[model samples]
Target: MNRPAPVELCHKNMRFLITHNPTDSTLNSFIEVLKRYGVTTVVRVCDSTYDKAPLEKDGITVVDWPFDDGAPPPNKLVDDWLTLLKKKFQEDPGCCVAVHCVAGLGRAPVLVALALIESGMKYEDAIQLIRQKRRGAINSKQLTYLEKYRSKQRLRFKDPHTHKNKCCIM
Candidate 1:
């Protein structure tokens, strides 16, 4: 099934593009579009066995973080993932990150919201922004989790080589 073009989310110093699963035909085109928008990184938050595999060529890096439908990742997991993303962002400020799930609905939104919240956006505001960009991004359960979610101690990832600690968004 042919999917719609990826939607451009917040774009400025950093660009975020979100989309549904792309069919074989749409994958290349989508990559090209992402390239046009300076997207050098992609995070596939879908299940394994999706058609296309990630590539690290042409100045793009794709990584997979799969989860079952409607299952939001745990806070630590989110923190770890966001830490990796932040490291990538910090490495190349001009790079854009594209995140997607099966339908760009439940899981994708949750990940995006967490990323934004970590980046200092209010929970309610993050939901609103995602909903405006793509309707049906989060359902009630996810919303509830967001509402009640709080971290006692922030998780950070340090580069083993450089020993530099990288913090996730807030």
Candidate 2:
């Protein structure tokens, strides 16, 4: 089965490339394309068994955060994961970080959405923007988490009596 190619998520300011896991046939091409995009680092959010040694040898820094598909990492891991991406962006302003899971639709976009939220974008807008870039970017379960996260934020700051309607319904 032929999989679709990678999609570049953002271009106006900070850049991120989102794509599915590369197979043996697509590995070399993936590296070349990422280089063309000025991607100096890769965040591998697929299973640990998916080898990325080739990418590492190509001089692109790759960080692994393996987990099953259709699920987000633990809350603590999510925090640490975002921290690592933040540091990478700080180290090189021009860097394009490529993030991927098996299909780049579910898990990869969740991370991208969270990063955008951290970068000061509203969760709704961030998800919309990502969806524009790559259709079906986040699955329903992932969207639920984003909504839950947003609701938690509102709960932490807003008065329940005044903002109960604005908080998460769940």
lDDT per residue for candidate 2 within 1-170, as digits (tens), equals 55567888763245789988877777888889988998878888887534678877878888888777887667876876667765766566546889888888888889888877766677899899999888877888888888776422211122225855566567
Candidate 1 lDDT by residue in tens digits, 1-170: 65445677662234578878665666677667777878777777786434445345466776778777887776566866777667766676546678888888888778777777766667899899989878778888889888877643222323346736667887
The whole-model lDDT of each prediction reads 0.70, 0.75
lDDT of 1 at 12: 28
Write down the TM-score of every candidate.
0.77, 0.81
The residue-level lDDT of candidate 1 at 114 comes to: 77
Candidate 2, residue 95: Cα displacement in angstroms equals 1.1
- List where candidate 1 sits over 4 angstroms from the true fold: 1-4, 11-13, 49-54, 151-170
Model 2, runs deviating above 4 Å: 11-13, 48-50, 150-170
RMSD value for candidate 1: 6.6
> Residue 141, candidate 2: how far off, in angstroms?
1.1
Best by TM-score: 2
